[model samples]
Target chain A: MALDKQFIGREYGPYRYTLGEEKMREFTLAVGGAKPGAGTPGEPPAHVSPLLYDEQAAKAGPHGGLIAFPSFAVVFAIRPFSAAIADPALNINMQMLVHGEQDLEFLDVMRPGDVMTTTGRIADLYERARMGFVIVTSESRNQHGTLVVKGTWSAIIRG
Target chain B: MPRTYQPGDTFTHVRECDRYRPIYYAGASGDYNPIHIDPEAGSAAGLNGNILQGLCTLGWVVEAIAGFVEDPGRVRRVKARFSRPVRPEDTITFQGRVTAVQDGRLTAEVSATNQRGEDVLKGAVVEAFIG
Candidate 1:
């Protein structure tokens, strides 16, 4: 089914997510981040390692707590948008969908316990000879109403 | 802790894709697409097997940039094109180069290749704000 271009400006939600330390750690480990001073990847060393993986750095990190990794916002931002596109009104085919491109802009830090609200919009819709494209842009804001991050997720649905 | 980035300096980050990477990321990121979690589902989709999420691969590159700048928030902007599928057991390497520094922002061009030497992230760019 061809994606409806009329849905381009449709918005999804402002779902809330409270950041968690354990989630940050799990994401760090799953991505194969090389913990400082550990040959096989483990705990973070004080003087080195990315702030997202280091407890000490987290203490001194941006927002003064456990900071989520650059890509960690995905955990908080993708679900609502998924629901938006799956609306029977849109009639999107799920079986042949594949991610094609992604873009992210981090404007503020997201620390553990911070409440983030994520909202999404269908930014654009188009078609190639054998495929349909849907671009969704999401914005995440902290409890204080400060924009924390923005992401553009583009999926190419094979025809 | 702030780290200075200079133009022309290069760094490399290599990671082995855990056999269960797809499942792990699927749970963490809430992308439960069968193409990334079930091998049989992948075959039906014409892939070699359960393929890892492209964003998961991009995560490594973001981590590398965060490591370079010493803070994840310092990474201002990032974008990537999913050129190829990454299957289980792929050894992905991120090769980053400081292409330019302008107005307190450092830009890096990244090339991520798999065990087979294919450029999985053929066109990727990362911009970090240092000022």
Candidate 2:
């Protein structure tokens, strides 16, 4: 069944999330190729910038504080796309769906203790080569109302 | 002082999808999709085995550029298509070439390949502020 085009403009959220220091480090190291074990997120990899894990080093660096890895925005910004796909109205076949593409634009750095609010809308729905494509666009703002991150997410549902 | 960048500058980064990485990434990213953490589910879905989260692979693209610019905070944009699944025990090598440097910003094209030399991402591009 084809996805209903009427759902294109449907909005997902004003989801809010509070950044945490340890969580940021854990994410950075996990993606940076670190090996995690009991009671630790693992050591930061040699190539990972200290700005993402070392508080003191980051504080002394240009940003003057610990900054989350750029893609960390996906943690909160993905809420809407996740919500849209899982929405019962869409009735998407979960097993046949795969993430197709992603685009993220970071307007400013994100720091721990910063409160982020995200909202997104179904941008488009179409069929290509017998497969369904669902596109969602999201915007995340900080406590001060600065647009910190923007994302375009696509999902392909196999026919 | 910020480092200068020019078109044609190249950088590389490599990562291995260790057996437990998907599970660890699931814990950290809140993406516990069974296909990424459960081999049984993956097999049922026709993947043969578990695969890494596409976003985790995207994160590596960010790392490649962040390392080049010397600051994670300077990464301005990253975009890519998931062309293939990255499975456990697979090693991915990312190579990036600076494509443009303009208006205090730099743009680069990145290619991600697995050990078999299959492309895992397509149209991968990253941009960062260098000034």
Candidate 3:
């Protein structure tokens, strides 16, 4: 069965998230290939930037403080897209769903204590080659109302 | 002195999907989908085994550019299509080539390939600010 077109413009979230310095470090290290274990996110890899994990170093660097890894935006920004797929109305089969594509634009650096609020809407729903595609667009703004991130998330439902 | 970058410049990064990486990523990213953490669940989902989160692969793409610009904060954009699943024990190598440098921003086209030589991401592009 095809996805219902009526939910095409369905919207999700003004989800709010507060960036934490340690969480930011953990994410940066994990993606940087740190072997995370009990009580630690693992030692920072050599290639990992201090701006993302070393508070003191970051405070002394150009940004003047710790900054989230660029893609850390996905942590909170994914809320709306996840909600859409799990929406009862969408009736998407969890087993058949797979992330298909992603686009993220960062307009400003995110620092600890920055509050981000994100909102998103289903942008399109269509079937191609017997597969269903769900596209969603999201925008996240900081407490100061600066647009910090914009995302285009896509999911494919195997047919 | 600041570094200079121009079109045709290239850089590479490699990542391995260690057995527990998906679980750790789930803990950090709040994506606890069973298919990513449970081999049985993945098999039931037709994946044969648990797979790494595509977002994590996307993060590697950001790392490639951030390393190129020498700053993570300078990364302005990253986009890609997930062409294949990255399973545990798989090593994906990311190779990026600068395609444009204009108005203080540089764009690079990136490709992510597994050890088997299969492309995991298609149409990958990253942009960063240098000014």
Candidate 4:
């Protein structure tokens, strides 16, 4: 069975998310971030992986305070889309669904403690050959209402 | 201090995909697709064994660029096409070069390959604000 083409442009979620510092640290370490204190012995050295640990990066970098990797926006923005697909209306065959391609465009940096809201929509739905494709685009906005990130997530399902 | 980046600068970072990468990424990113964490399920589904998530490999690419740029927030955009599945224990290498600097944005053309020299991410591009 083919997915409902009407689900295209169907919108879901202006979900709220507050970024956390601990999660940022954990994600950094899990992705093979530099182990701590590899800094110079005699010096009060600069912390490695400032992207995850350095407040100075906030001062010198784009966003301040304890920061996160660029991809953390996925965590903030993904929930609603996942919920949308699971709503049974789409009839997504879980066993046959495959992630096709993903991309992100950053308009503003997301920082820890920023209360972000994400809204997602089924951007496109179409069929080619025997496969059904759904493209979901989500936009995350920071507390200041700045559009922090916009991402497009594509899933291909067997028809 | 934010170091100035110029075009033609080059660097590389190598990551060894630990056995638990997919699991951790799954927990953190909320993509609990069984192919990434359950070996039996994946093998039953003909993947041979559990495979790492594609976005996790994309994370590695961002890490490499962050290390080079020295500021995670400076990264403005990242895009990649998953050309191959990344398995546990695979050593993935990312080589990047500053291809252009126009206005305040710096562009780097990045390429990713596994230890066997198989292309895992191709035509990858990253843009960051250098100003």
Candidate 5:
């Protein structure tokens, strides 16, 4: 089904996501990053340093700040895309989908253990021949509603 | 503790993305999309050739930031948008600047641009510094 341009700018929910350090490490490892000081595929290239642990403590503690993973915002922005694809009127099949493109803007840093709420919207929709493209942009904020990240994702649908 | 930094501080490296370095990212990340590995599939899909996963570029950017801050775990946030595709044999350079330093946090605007000068991904990263 063709995407509706009218949905552009339509906002979705303020979904919440919690940041975790182990998950971030797992994700980095999963993506082939070298571990700190370990010369292995997907591990960080060098030791992360003990100073980071102190910083992490400060950020994760009360009255401290938050530290967010690089691509953590991807989890939040998927909401609007799911809603758009799940719409009965759109009739999109989950199996044939492809992630065409993605864009993210970090306005502020989030610490591990920080509570974040994400609000999303359909930013753009268009079609080329047999393919339809839908773009969803989401903004993530802390509990105080302070903006942390703005993410824009594009999915290409082909029939 | 106080930390000192200069504006022109930069580090650069080049690695070959070849057969041995195979696109192992697909299975590890569940992003087993054909365009990253199957050259024929990529060509059939209208791509100039087999393309590197966008996340790989992100991983490189993360590595650059980790180097700059000297601590991978201190990276609090990374925000980027994929602007173009990085095909096999495409050498990418990650360039960044220390745009801001305030209240012990260093903010840098970084990007991955290809040999063609086209931006493959661009974003800002914020890291907490402990000195």
Candidate 6:
């Protein structure tokens, strides 16, 4: 089924998420990266640093909260795609899709305890010669309504 | 405390694009795009070759910073704009510089350049220096 052009510019909900340290560790491990732990005498892990949760160390930054891992925002930004694909109205088969491109802009750093709300919109939808493309843009804001991150995702729907 | 970095402080790491790496990233990221896996599908879509997922390249950048700080937690913020597609067999060199250090925070401009020296990703990363 072809994508409905009218869906373009349509906005989705302001879904909320809470950042957690364990989740970060899980994401890292799932990505084939090492988990943070104390180093041994001769061998140290390639990835994983406890500095993220050290209050004294992170307090050195402009924000006093624990510094988030660089790719932490991916957790929040990816939710909307599943929602869009699951919408019965769209009829998008998840298996027949490919992620074409993605871009993210961090306006500010978010702390571990920060409660963030993300609102997504179908920014663009088009098709070309049996292939379809959908672009979704999601903006995440902290509890104070401060913009934390803006994410753009493009999916290619194969016919 | 204001910290300034000289030109010689820059660091670079080159990575070979392994075909299987994209599948690994796809499983982790939940992005199953055929172009990243199926060569014929990618060619049919007008891609020069089976391209790597954008997040996979971002993951490399994350890996680069993770090596520098020795701890992923020290990174406060990271953002990047994907400018080009990364093809399989292409070697990408991750480059970074300490652009500024203000109020005890370190700001670095980082990028990934292909073997052709074309910029694939460009962005800034902010890290908290415990030292």
Give the TM-score of each candidate.
0.89, 0.98, 0.99, 0.87, 0.61, 0.63
Give TM-score values for chain A, per-prediction: 0.83, 0.98, 0.98, 0.81, 0.72, 0.81
lDDT of 3 by residue, A48-136 (tens): 99989987899999899899999999999999999999999999998889999999999999999999999999999989999999999
lDDT of 2 by residue, B18-79 (tens): 99999989989999989999999999888898999999999999999999999989899999
Candidate 5 vs. truth: CA RMSD?
6.0
- Write down the lDDT of every candidate, Cα atoms only: 0.80, 0.95, 0.95, 0.77, 0.61, 0.67
Going through the candidates in order, their DockQ values are: 0.54, 0.91, 0.91, 0.52, 0.26, 0.26
Worst 10 residues of 6 chain B by lDDT: B1-10
Per-residue lDDT of candidate 6, residues A1-159 (tens digit)? 489987877777779988776554444443433323333112213444444444676566445556665566777776776577566777887656666666666666666778889889888888987988888888889999998778877777778
Which parts of model 2 have CA positions greater than 4 angstroms off? none
Across A1-159, the per-residue lDDT of candidate 4 in tens digits comes to 477887778888889998887666656655553323333112211433654655675566545466777887787787666876676898787766666777888887666788999998998888888898888999988989898898888777755
- Candidate 6 — which pairs collide? A49-B71, A52-B73, A98-B33
lDDT of 4 at A106: 80
Q: Supply fnat for every model shown.
A: 0.73, 0.90, 0.89, 0.60, 0.25, 0.32
Which clashing pairs does model 2 show? none
Q: What order do candidates take by TM-score, descending?
A: 3, 2, 1, 4, 6, 5
* Model 2's DockQ score: 0.91
lDDT of 6 at A53: 44
Model 6, runs deviating above 4 Å? A28-32, A35-50, A53-56, A59-65, B5-11, B14-53, B62-92, B96-131
Q: Which has the higher lDDT value, candidate number 4 or candidate number 6?
A: 4
True-structure lDDT of candidate 2: 0.95
Q: Lowest summed-lDDT stretch of 10 residues in model 2 chain A?
A: A43-52
lDDT of 3 at B79: 99
Model 2 reaches an interface RMSD of 0.6
Q: Second chain only: TM-score per model?
A: 0.94, 0.98, 0.98, 0.93, 0.82, 0.83
